[model samples]
Target: MQKLAGVLQNFFNQAHAKGRLRRECFGNLIYYRLIDDSQPFRRGTVIFEEGTLIPGYPQIGRMIRLDKGLKEQFTKPFWAEEKVDGYNVRIFLLGERLLGVTRGGFLCPFTVDRLPDLIDERIFSDHPDFILCGEIAGPENPYLIGSPPFIKEDIQLFIFDCQRKGEFDYLSQAEKHQLMEHYSLPSVRNFGLFKAEDILAIKQLMMTLDTEGCEGLVFKEDVPRGKRSKYVTSDASLSDIQAMARYLPDFPPEYFIGRILRSVIFLDEEGISSTHELKAQLGSAFIDGLLKAIKQCQREHRVYHRFRCRLHDRANARQLLAHLARGDGHIQIVKHRLVREGEFYIFEFDKVFQRTTGLLGELLSGEMVYD
Candidate 1:
């Protein structure tokens, strides 16, 4: 079944070897280069083979890190609310039509930044097998805002994952909330089966979701209380740069990502010879928001939020890679084998996977790791 033109001609006859690229062409769709240029992909993103075209989990509710002694061991009638820090979306309905992705995998190109708001895109690029993972949040969106501002953000879809029609696996957590309230899609305020004396009340409800900016709490064990582990992400950012990357010292590895980019001073401030041109126009607009926030945090594989700058030579690196390749947005080539000599400088856009190659087997799974 690999006929998409023989899977786009064996994905560009192997992306580029010797120089190690093999694929990167755009205009049709392609992407693969898993982590060469010296590995560095700390999380997830790049999910194809099921209908790619992601971006959906902006969120609205169900992030309530529950646990007051597992709330009386959750006697099966559960539902809690309000626990936001922002961003974590997903929405994909099958028998009706809807699609989105953002729990790392992106695809939203602003349409009021959609969410559980499906209108039909074939649930996401024509399906074959079933699918419908969800998350997008805000405990409840009144409207919108960003950075660190909010009057009330918005977005919430939270379905979790259904992939097939086994209705909801080995059930029980009150039968997966009566099959997510008979497919209304939004269940999990309470689904406990706790023991070990509820891990110190779910670690004090993850320190009350890190003192309310929420971002921490996940300890799955739900398979009639057994088979559902490894699913946790909530330290949304207690930020102090994780205690300064824990006592920084030679802290520039993981393919270098500390992009403050412009600052003769002011990572926290330190430079004012009569406000030297107001610190060079606030270090060139924080080095243009550190190259547009490192192309939006390496397009989702956050890589523990790193992004540095301050390079140019090579004729300002072909005019900053031809001004980030004449923007329209599309930059996810996080550090591909970077290296530099003195006065240090590195940019490595890993040729953005030759240029795009059908998104490289959904970035790394197709061709299933060289089959």
Candidate 2:
């Protein structure tokens, strides 16, 4: 620990001066979280005082054109897995304690509190050094406004990759599958192997998933040190626009523009004509979403996404709320947000999109913009 701290002192000092590195405590654990990329360390990198380091999850490049992207990106057979639409988190065992760290390098109290219901503790007991990377998705999640149609109620964890404590490279697909099967772990569905030339098969799969309202696929090469790329379904892009249209001003125009372009390309590539139903779906995604936002602002004087989750401990719920309060003026936790329901505590809150809320409020109240 002393040596590692010494090695990191210069970088830490520079990062601290820039307000990019943050030192936070989770109970007895003292750690440093990188709020932004600083030289060699990426944003979301977490380093513990006791020498445990959970590196930030790397961003996977997206493929807009599968035919060209596959041939250009991969030289060998690759395995395709369903890309679940949810927040990303890394779960690890720290001195017999199971903890969930979010993509932003924060120790999530909500995820930690609900870990028992998501995974078997025996996997941690067996492999204490394992860093399980996965997605936490469903309606009951506190982070996302949208959830996959498959999960009706509570959230579920789908393990997609595994890494050792000190290693940067992920385990191969087969190795990950072996461990998952042995531990009876829930994982993303695999769509089998495909070579670069298997464009027709992949297109068929993408269309099938799009029809079912599921997200796209992530293609992982089978080699020991292979690369990965992601491709989302047109429906997934539309869903994103539909869900986030209420907070449209909060996001860049590029966000919606990029999705629109992808949908157009996807439809053209699949050789599908723009039918009336398809055009109506696209139009309603924006119109309906904006209408809902307007109504919500008129009714409540705010535009926000409501989030709910279950926790085993009330203290963790408080901790989660406190952590959120430390962020920018986006999260709003009411007085009675935490309620004891049966054995577990039901925690609820709202993620307020301040820009959209303010704009809508002014417009509704007859305010005029010069621009």
The TM-score between candidate 1 and the true structure equals 0.25
lDDT for each residue of candidate 1 in 1-371, tens digit (9 for 90 to 100):
13224553344234234433322222233433211231122122222332332222222222232333334344433222223333444444423434343443333322123442423343344443334554344422211112222224334444544433212233444554655665555543442445535556555554454345454333434444333322112233213123222212213333123222212212222222465554454444435534443453346423222222324243433343443344324433344433464653443443232223233324443354354
Model 2, residue pairs in steric clash? none
| Candidate 2 C-alpha lDDT tens digits along 1-371 | 34366667676767878888789999878888989776567788888877788878888999998899999999999999999999999999989889999999999998998888999889999889999999999999877889998899989999999999867788888899999999999999999999989989998999999998899999999776588999999999989998888788777799899999998888877878755777788899889988999999999988888888888898987788788877766545453488989988888888887888888899989999998
Candidate 2: residue 92 Cα off by (Å): 0.6
Per-candidate TM-scores read 0.25, 0.94
Candidate 1 residue spans exceeding 4 A from truth: 1-55, 62-128, 132-160, 163-191, 194-200, 203-215, 218-236, 240-371
What lDDT does candidate 2 reach at residue 60?
91
Q: What is the lDDT of residue 268 in candidate 2?
A: 76
Taking all chains together, the TM-score of candidate 2 against the true structure is 0.94
